[model samples]
Structures are given as C-alpha cells and as structure tokens.
Target: MDQDRGYNNYYSSRNSRQYEESSNWRRGNVNWDSQWPTDRYSNSDYYGYTRSDTPFNNYNQSSARYEEDYSRNSYELDPRTMEFDRLVELLHPKFMSEYLNKILTFLKSNNTEICFPHIAPYKEAFLVRIASDHKNLECPAFDETCQNISRSIRDFLYKNSKLFVWSHSYESGKITKNTADTASSPNVILKSSSSDAIDKDSKHKQSRLKKKQIELVSTDFKIQAMKTILDFIKDDSRSLLQYPDLSEVQANFLYTLLSCYDKPEDGAEKSLLLTPLVEALKIYSLKYQFRINKDTNDEDCRFITLEKTLKGKSSENNFNDSLKSPSPSIMDYQDLDDWNTDVENSDATDHRSDGVPDFGGKLNKNQRKLRYLFDQVTTDFKMTVLQKSLDYIEDNSRSSVQFLNLTIHESRFLKCLNSFPLSKKSYFLIEKQCVPLIMKLRRVLEP
Candidate 1:
C-alpha cells in the first residue's frame, strides 16, 4: 500500500509541474485584451473563410495581431507625450513662480526698466521661462499653442540680442519755464478790419475768423509736444524695445499729435516727426540715392527757406554757387552698353581658394567699373544736384529777409547722412558740394 501511494504522489507532482509549464507558455504567446483563443484558429469560423488549409488565413491573423499590438503600445513612450507631461509639470503654480522669479531677477540685474508694452504679466513670465530654458527644454509637438509660445520666445530673445537703440533727443531734459515763455511768443497773427457801415457783415466775418483761429493751434504747442515724446524715450526707452519696427512708434507719436491739431500752420503742417523719420530711413536707402521731396506742395520744401535764412553769411556763397551752373541730368552718365558687350565676350574666369567657382567675381568687376563711372562724373553735375536741392528749398523770393531752410528747425540732416554707406568719392563729392550748405543751414538752425 505504501509503494502504491508513493507512485500516485510522484505522478500527481509530475502532472502539476507540466500544467505550470503549459500555462506559462500560453501566457507568453497570447494577448489578453480581446476575447481569448483568437477564434480557436479556425478558418471556417462565422467570421468565415472557405479555405480552411490556406496559409493566407494565418497571414491575415498575424497581421491583425501585429496591428493590435501596435495600437496597444504606440503612444506608451512617445516624445510628444513626454514633453506634454513635462510642460504640465513645469506649468504648475509653484514651478511657474520659480521661472517668474528668475525673470524678475534677470531684469533687475540688467537695469532693464520696462517690460514689453503689449504682453500681459503672465505671458511675459512664460516668454522669459522659454527664453531662459530654450536649449534645455522641449515643447510638445502636438500642442500648437505651446509651439507658438516657444517660437515667440526664440524670436524675442533673438531681437533682444541684436537690439538697436533709437537715440533719444531729450538732451536738454525738461523744457524750462523761461524757454517755454520764449517759445510761446506769437510769430504770426491774422487780423481783418471792416467798416462799421457794414456792421452785420463784419459781425458774421469776425465770427468766421474767430472759428478759423480756433482751428489753428500755435506752432509752439506742436514743438512742445515733440519735446514731450523725446522725454518719454529718454526716461523709459526699455518699454519701446519690444517693437520690431522702430519707425512705427515714431509715426504713431507724430500722427497722434497731428490728429489733435485741426489745421496746422503752413510750414509746420506735418508734425516734426516727418524729418527725423525720413532721416532714419535715409541710412538704409542711400545706395538708392534717397532724397526728400523739394516741391512747394511738399511741407519739407516750405521749411527750406527757413533753413537757408538761418545760413546767414553762407547764403551769399550759396547764391554764387547756384549762379555757377544749371542742374545735371541722367544723360551726364557714361553709356555702359560697351562695357556689357565686353563682359559678355570676355572668357576670363576666377576661382576661390577651395577650387569652387567664383560667380561673384564678374559682379565685383562690374561694380568696380560702375563706381569708376561715378567717380569720373563731372563736379558740375554734383554741384548741380546740390544746388537744385538747395534752391528747391525756396526760390530766394524774400531776398531782403533770409527765408528759413528746412534745416533751420533741425540740424540732424548731416548727422543722418553720416550714417549712410557713402563711397569715398561720393563722400568727397558731397562734402565739397553739399557739406558747406549743410553746415550753413545747421549753424543758422542752432537753438
């Protein structure tokens, strides 16, 4: 009986071990999410295929299995998901406060007095965080808002790195009481006199005149307004740094002031902003030979007499210079047709040190020749251009009382021109022909 019991026990133990191995193997092979058995691998099941023996059924089943496996684990370790999780973690109130404190510290350290004008405090904090941590951080690729925020941070950082200072003209600081009183002195007053015989007509006319006078603001007020804006820049230019285009702010300040004036004086029709705005643009456009309009309809032209009048003694020299010659024309330049033909026929070639073809060699050669042509142009033409610009400032009508040149109120013309990319010859030419005129105008216009 003992021997029989031992044999039964051994048999039972062996059966139990076999069952464990089989269960382990099944667990390894099967996916448990769907109903089990994979329809028992039967090709003729209700989800039916007529071919019971074909490998095609097995292939289809394997493909379905692969697709199910892919769907199950596809997003398990996705980079986008990871980044999204990180973003959420960092955006928590405590984590966000750390970033804001860092930004506030950076600003304090740098003496940067103002934040971007339009950005809200919270968004500014986010931008600071992104800029500070850009290289070490990642935004979720799937989250468009986060991506945009990231992009904006990069752009702001780049612009800040390459910031240009719009120089403030508030050198004199606040306008003084004495200066204000002097500025307030009326330069021009319009008066109308009519006989008492036509008393009703005179009353109506006087009423109309008073209304017109009300529309006309004093030029002094406009000058004072300009001074106010300059003071703002001097005090808090950090606030203006956020703008991509500096010109827009200048235009805005001028336009805002201009709108307040019903009908400005003839010469001061445009706010003082126009001159400086054009001056700033002149640097970028000098190669294109930018010049302010000198026609009478243009407000700038009206100011030229003021500029010239300020010139005083030099006005005699300018009169003599104007009498020296007529204006130069485009015809004065040499024909480049021959040069183009020569370039086309020439077989000359140059190569870079690295054996790459130098495509720009021909361009450089052409430009050199063009510069030579400019150099060879007659002094008369240069003189003519300068004279015409000066004369167009005015017809020299009130010769007894020197009229103001455009430079009278502002001596920034030469300063702005200095910023331009002038060739040596062009510089000398302008110096010889126009510098004296500019100097004269500036001297006269000096406050």
Candidate 2:
C-alpha cells in the first residue's frame, strides 16, 4: 500500500512539473539564459527574450536591446549641437545647412543697412535694425542678393501687366495706345516702346468717324435724288395727276440721280448742280399758289382778267375764245313769248329797245360755247394736267399728305360744282377746269 502511495505521489509531482512548463511556454516566459546560443545572445542580447539569432523578435525586445547598446557607447554632445543634428536629420543636410548659412551671412552683413523705404515697416524694420547694428559686416554682398530678388519681382509684375493689356484689348474689341491712355491714368504708362501700339486708338476713332460720314452722305444723296425727280415731273405739264402711273423708267432715273449724288469720289462740280434743281422745285411750289382758285365763279372773272392781263405777253393769243360777251339785264325779259323768242333767236345778233341791243342773244351763244369748252377742259385736259402734277408731287415731294391737303384751295370749287344750278354741260365745265387747277396747285405747293 505504501508503494502504491509513492507511485501516486511521483506521478502527481511529474504532472504538476509538466503543467508549469506548459504554462511558462504559453506565457512567452522562455528561459533565454539557458536556451539561447551563447555566442549569439552574449552581452548584446536584446532585453531578455531577443538575441541576434532571431530575426523575428517583437518590437519591445529590439527597442530594449538598442537602448542598452546606446547607453553603453553613445558620446555626450552640446544641447545645441544635438538639436542641430536632429534638425539636419529632419530636414536634409544639404538644404538646411545652405539656408542657415545664408541667413547668418545676411544678418551679419546687413547689420547697419536699411533694406526698404521708411513706410514698409514689416519688411524694413528687421533689415534696418540688422544693418544699423552691424558695422563690421560686408553689406555689398547682401545688397547684391536683394537687388537680384527685386529685379525678379519687377520682371514678374511687368509680364503680368502685359498679359492684362492684351486680355483687356481683346475683350474691348481692340486695344490701342490711346485706349490704354484713356483706361489708365497719365502716371500709368504701359512699358511699351512700339509706335504702332500707340497709334491703334487713333485709327479706331478715325474708322468710326468715317463710317458716320458715309451714312450722312447716303442720306443727303437720297434727299437730293428725290428732289430731282420731283422737278422733272413738275416741268412736264402733260402728266396725269389724279392717278399717275409710276413707271420703272422714272424709278430708275430717280435711283440714278441718287447713285450719282452718293458717289463718294464724285467732284464738287457734279454735286453743285443739284442745288439749283432743288431751288427750282422750291420756286415752283411757291409760285403755284398764286395762279389758281377753286370756285368757278371766282375764277371765271379772274380767268377773263388773267387772259386780258396776259394779252400780248405771249406770242400766241389764245384769249379770244375765252372772252365774256355783254348780256341783257333780267328786266329786259318782257313776257314768256318774248323770252321764248329771245331764247330761239339767241343765235341772232340784235339791239334791245334800251339800246343794250339784242346783244344778249349773241352773248348767250358765246357763253354756251365757253361752257362747252370748260367741260372738255375739266374732264380731259385739266384732268391730265392735274394727274401729271400729282404724279410729280408723289414722286418728289418731301412734304406730308396732310400738309398738302390743308394748303390746296380746291374744296370751294368742289362745293360750287355740287351747288351749281346749271345744265350738265355747264356743271361739267366748271368741275373740270376750276377744281383740277386748284388741286394741281395744292399738290405742287404742299406735296
């Protein structure tokens, strides 16, 4: 029984030892002093777990070993030198060393110098202080560097200014020196030496002025041409006025006149000819008003008087046919038979008892003939004249229709025709001769 107890005790002791070993292995607490290779893990062993033998050591092992190596062999240096070394490591040695040397040299040399004008305090203050404080410094070397930097900045500004001018000119249609001068103040000269650049503005202004002149010339030419056509039509008395036809030939003539007037290269002499033509048209309009009246009755005496007045004025005397004959008074008619006899023998020449003679018979016959003549003139001849006059006005007159309508005196003649208690022949005569002439005058004057 004792032997069995001993076996049990031994077995329990061995199992406990195995369990402890397994727990130590799982916890990563290996005995490196005993298990590690002597040469590899000698004094350079990393912490307790790592040695040069294991490339797969964790971060803690590597860090502890590195710290131990540094503590043993690292040399002490000045704090500033150490810090500079750290900075040099952080930045690169080449760039940091060069920049630091430049700064040191600039500060030492410019000790007593002023770097900028008085107003630029932020940039100038440090420079001035350094320059003023350092007397034994080489300032020329530093000034040279600063000068180079200033030149570079100036060059950059100049390039940008040129670009601005180019873009502004493109946007505003064109750019010239004059435009630039206008856009910028006198103090702001674009640093340009080209003469052509300065002349661009003057050229643009000239071009615009020329365009306006051409427009004015075109308008003037049209006015002159219209005036010419009007004169031509007015001078021709055979034109139809009431409904005048506008022929292509007349239109072409008007167009030709306009074209000639508009000819930019034409001589002054050619243009001078238009002035008289215009004046003639004006004169014709002015003179037309005095020649006629609308009322046939008003015009009847006037017409006789005019013919009488015009007698011997013209080579051909056409007044004889238009003269009024002496007629007997209403009191001379005695009775219906006497009146009938008078009417029947109206064709005869006789003397009344009053010694007025039976001149009434001849007078009545002549008056009838005059009335017939007036009718023919009104329907055919006067109409032709009126139509022609209107045609001229329509083609030439610059005046408005309302102006012409108001100025013409034909309304009274039309009223007279409407109210006249005459036979158809007499009425037709009065209508044709009196109304048409008045209307023609109106057209000429107003149209």
Candidate 3:
C-alpha cells in the first residue's frame, strides 16, 4: 500500500511540472534568457530568415531608387539653378538665417565687400540685422559682413538679371533698349574688328540710347499725367464735357496708355485702379470714339478723335453735337448705290442730278431681281393655296346636296383671303421689300 502511494505522488509531481511549463508558454512568459540561445534573442538576429526576407531589403531597395532618381535629376537641379531660386526667394521682404548664410557664403567665396548704394533702397539696415543674427557677432565685423553679403547679392543679381524676370535697373533698361534697337535695325552691320566702323557704331548706339532714355522719361511722365486725367474723369460723370475738343493725339495717347494697363497679368493694384477708369471711359461713350486719318490709314492711327466741340455751344447740352456736323465727302454711305447706277447709265444719254433715282434703275439690280423672283414665288404660293381651298370646297359641294351652303362657304373664304394683310399684290409690297431691307440692315449691323 505504501509503494502504490509513492508512485501516485511521483506521477502527480511530473504532471504538475509539465502543466506549469505549458501555462508559462501560453502566458508568453517563457524565460528565453534561460531556454534559448543568447544569439537568438540578440537584436542583430534575423530569426530563421535570411537578410533578403527582412524589412532591410525593402529599405535598401527604396534607398537605391532614391539614389537613381537623384542621379537622373542632378543635371537640372545644379548649383546655378539652386542659386537662381535663392535669388528669386530673396526678392520678398523677409528672409531667414538659412538664406543669409547662403548669401554670406557666396559673398565670402567671391571675396567681395558690400557697398551702400549698390543694394536696394531701405534694405541695408535690415540686412545688417540679418547678418548679426546669423553670426551672433558684434560691432564693425557684423556690419562689414552684412555689407559684403548685400553687395555680392546685388552684383550677382545685376550680372544675371536677364535670367530672371523682375524689373531691371534704369541703366539696364538702356542696355535692353540698345540691344533691341540694334536687333531691329538689320541695316547697321557689325564689323568685328574695324576701328572706324566700331567708332561709328558706338556713336550711333550712344545717340540712339540717349533718344530712348529721353523717350522713356517722357513716357513715364505721360503715364503719370494720364493717371491724373483718368482720376479727373472718374470724379465727375459729365467731366468729359471739360474736354469737348480732345485732339487726335491726346485721344490716342490716352487709349494707348489704357491698353497697356489693361493686360490680363496686371498686378492687383494696377487692375484695381484701371477697372474704374475703363468703366468711366466706356460710360462716357469714348469706347468706340476714334478719328480716321486718311494719310496713314493704319488701324492704330495717331490722330484719334474721341470728341469734338461746337463754336459758342455748351459741352453739357451738346454731348453728341458732333453727330449734327456735316458728314465728310469721303464718308458717303449713299455713294455706292449712286456709283453703281451711274455705271449702269454710263452708256445711256440722259442723266439727271437727283443722285440715284428711286425708280427702276435706282435700286440695286440684284436686290430688285431677288425681290421680283420672291414676289412671283409668293404669288404662285398664294394662288396654290386659293386653288386648294376651292378644290376642298368643290369636293364638299359635290358630296352635299345643299348648294346654298357651299356658295356661302366659298364667298366667306374669298372675303377672308381679301381681308388678309399679305394676300393681295398691293398689301404684299412690305413683304416684297422686307427681305432686301433685312439684307441691307444685316450688312450695316455687322461688327
């Protein structure tokens, strides 16, 4: 009995040890430190998989792709392109330490010193602050560094201004004008090495440059004056009365000036100012007002007339007084018909001075022919309609034994046809002339 008890105790102890191990595994509390190999738990271990099966492969693949893309794009994103982008960014009012450092590095490399007048107006002090903040330095050293950076940036921009699109300096403007003028004038031949030719070319270019500079100055003044004129126009609706005798030159200058500001890409401030000015001009009936110059005959004529004034007449009362003026002999609208009639009668003996007669040969032949054909077609159509109505009435009369009813209906139909506004020849005159009149009207109304 004691031996049996010992066997039962031994089995119970073995089962208890196995159950404890299983529970620990389920609870994820298996002592890996004691049960597994030391290397198995190491961070460097890849379990049972090779490096190819690990996430490192994915990371390596992406890194390789990034390197390949960088290599492919390196040409376009070169140092020069980056520097240009940096310059454009610097055009804004504020910039950061990163931009300052870049400018400083470039300036130091170039071995340049900053000068006051070279930089943009009112930006030197701000640049000084930027330099101080960037280097955390004091005194003359900070100021000197700032000046160098500023001067370098300005020089760099001046040298490469063509690569960008911002407004050029007044001096650069002359250079551009000279280049453009030279390009436009193919007659001026360039001798690469002839001294006399070079001297002559230089003198010619200088003269042209001076003229362009004067023109540019004049244009600027004119633009300012035009703005004042536009403001005056906007102030009073009837103020256009103030300029009843606006000359062709003055009108053209205003038109050209307005067109320049009417660009789609105009800045916010320009658009805001120009919108009301354009509206005012349009409202004052100046939109379609222009004078024709017979000499030039060019679409953009110099002598454009927006308005004209009468002698001893108030402008406000006679806003459209110019309309009452005798039409120019050159602007003869009725002359075409008269000319054609004269050509038709050129072979005939009798001629009257009542211009073109309003009778047979008076009207346009094609228009008259078209009208006659249309009248004939319309008459035939009306006759056909009348015949069809008579046929229908006759058929009904044959089927019915009531002759009085048939005669009454026929008389009533004839009376209705006579009463129609366009049934008869005389009443159809308006209709006959309608097509030609509309055709002529269409020609006149064409834009």
Candidate 4:
C-alpha cells in the first residue's frame, strides 16, 4: 500500500514538473514544441485517468483556441493600458446593484427547492439537508444557479470588495478590510490514507463535509454580515448613503461574501473573495476608515469607507431618505436591529474557518491542480464546470456497480480541465465559490 502511494506521488511530481517546465514555453520565451503527453496512463497515476481515455470530442475546441490566442497574442490586446474599469465597463453600477437587490429579494422570498433533473443518491441527502438549512438561496453545487443571483453577488462583489481600502486601491487589489486576517490557505482535506481500522473515526468526520459546497456560504453568515454593515451605517456611514452608486442591500451582499473566504486551498478561496470585494467597493466608491478617536477597545473599523466624489456628484441627497435600511422584513425578521441583536449573540464571521466548515481537510496533488484550474477560470466558467462534475457524480453514485472507474465522458471532462489554459492573477477576487462538488469528486476518485 505504501509503495503504491509513493509511486503515485512520484509520478505526480514528474508530471507537475513537466507542466511547470512547459510554463516557460507558454510564456513564449523559448521556441518549444508543446509536448503534450500522448500516453494514456502516464499522467493518470494520481488523477486516475490518462489522455487517451478522455477524448477532446466533448470539450470546447473554440474556447481552447481563444484562450490559446488570448494567452499568446499580447500585441492584440489594446495597446493603451486598459484599466480594470475599462475591462469590465459593461457592468453598470445601477444595473448591478438593482439586479442584485431583486435577486436578494427572491432569495429571501424563496420558500421551496427547485427539483433537479438528476441527483446522486449519496448527494441527494446532503443537498436536501443543505437546502433545508439555507431557507432561500440556491445551491450552485447541485443545480446550475451560478449565473443567477448567486453568481452576480459572488462574481460582482468578489471583483469589487477590495476596492474598499485602496492599499494603496485595497493595496491595488491585494487585500480587504473585512477579510484582512483570513487564513492564507484552507484547512487540509482530511482523508483516510490506509484501509486500516483507525480509518473509521476519520471517515465519520469526513462524512460530515462529504457534500460541502464549493462556495461555503450559509444564510446565518450573510445575516451576520448584513448586521455588521448596518452597524457601520448606524454608527458612521459618513453620509456614504448619500452616494448614488452605493446601496444598502448591495453593501450587505458584498460584506457577506468577501468575508466568507477559506483556504485549506480550495475553490472560493480568499483571493476570489478579496478581488471582487475590492472591485465592487471601488465601483461604488466606498471603503472602511478607522475611527481614530476610538474607546481604545475597538480592534478595527468595519470595511465601510465611501468616496463622495467617485462619480464627482455633489448632490447632497437625503442619505436616510434614499434607500430603505436593508432589512429581512420580507421574510420573518422585523427589522435590521432585530437581526443585529441575534447576530451579536451568534458568530459574526459565520463562514470563517471556525464555522461549520466544508474544508480544513486534506488534498492530493491532482486535487490541488484541480482546485487551481477552478481558480484560473472565470467565476461563471468555474461554476458551470463544477455543476457539470456534480451532475456526473450524482448520476454515477446511483449506479450499484462493483467498481466505479472513470467513464469516457468523465475522462474527457477531466482532460479538458487538465488541458484547459491555465491563468493566474496576483491577488484575490470576490470568489471562486464551488469547491463542494470537486471535493466530492476527489472523495469518489480517491476512495
């Protein structure tokens, strides 16, 4: 058993090293033949399948070409240094916030779950329990809701949240006031390394997080986040509400997600959260400033500073009379203050590492690469792929087969992920939310 594990690790290192060496080729520094592995089983030692097993028939060739072109043709990019705002100018603030407000309204009002086309036997129970736990919001892990309200909140806010501080612009997109002290990495993925008797205890704990979603968000945490924003507004909005670009509910969702980051190195990692958080804050022209004349006990100010001249608007609108104070009155809670009282008694940082965790476990090499693939892609793309894997897992889990080997279609999907153009960014963004399905996939493959 030990020999097999070591063997897997050895090949894993070799393949990754080869991939890294090719990284220089990718940079166009050398005239290199893109020596993609042709062997079927050579790279499958850790990941469990080889290239020949998964064909490119199912993958998007056009996207592959576009990414390749995008990667290679630096000269094609607009010669003038395009600002992040210029890159995403289409995302209008009024539309962004208003659309999100509607979604938030729907989420809070949603009473039942939408029946999915298919769900794995093992995952059904987990998804049901999760749906029950989260009264309104849709789970991107089970169904394709990534492009819906959830996607808008996570991607938009993840892009904007860090714009709050300006680290000199939240350290030019390095960190955020809300999640300044978040874990640099998530808890290691815990797995049974041996078929020995001691495995029983770990398996029990493992089962608890078996169906944890990629975006480890829960409603309780959002409530707490909403409470924090309201507290800041109540104490010192600094006439931030008077700013046309900023909205109460928009800020609530922004704080809720940017702060839900965890690393144990998984999807929806801290970088994802911070980037979007900063972007949104910058777009809204808002940030958190420290109260110098504190009572000395306060540790930090809430991330809620706002720039009055973000749009160069001098209109002194009634900050209080504009948008209503964001509240849960649509559902059960009477007002923001009511939820605030509840939050004070509960954990404020609900999705922080200490809460009901989806990660803080263990991971193998292929699994880490799989997670990195997720981070490199766009949020909607990552969420779509995660939804795909989840669908495959659900269908596969229902089969009462003697042994579950990778199907041809599954192989192709895996190949696409491994071969997908890798992208990297220097800082964190709003979120790369879905690690739930991949972790589940990891369990299935590894187990």
In terms of lDDT, the best-performing candidate is: 3
Query: What Cα-based lDDT does every candidate model obtain?
Result: 0.33, 0.32, 0.35, 0.32
Cα-based TM-score, every candidate: 0.20, 0.15, 0.19, 0.14
In candidate 4, what are the lDDT values of residues 325-429, reduced to their tens digit? Answer: 123122111222323344345433312232123333454333333333333345555556556544554562221111123333333333333322221210121
**After superposition on all CA atoms, how large is the RMSD of candidate 1?**
26.6
**Residue lDDT tens for model 2, 377-401:** 2344445534544554456322111
Between candidates 2 and 3, the one scoring higher on TM-score is: 3
Clashing pairs in 3: 114-147, 114-148
Give the alpha carbon lDDT tens digit for every residue of 1-447 in model 3. Answer: 232222222223434443333333334555545654534234453322233433334646634554454343332223223233332333342333334555445443433222233433223333433332322222232344444555565565456555422212211101111232221331211122233454566567755653444344344545555576566554533222222223344443344444433443321123343466556554543433312211111243333223333334433232221111122112222313434454454442222232222232443453332223233334434444344434443352221111121232232222333222232222222243333332332233233
lDDT of 1 at 73: 31
Q: List, residue by residue over 117-144, the lDDT tens digit for candidate 1.
A: 3433233334433433455335453245
For this target, which candidate reaches the highest TM-score against the unseen true structure?
Answer: 1
Q: Name the lDDT value of residue 216 in candidate 1.
A: 63
lDDT of 3 at 281: 50
- Candidate 4 at 316: error in angstroms? 16
**Residue 142 in model 4: lDDT:** 20
Total clashing pairs in model 4: 59
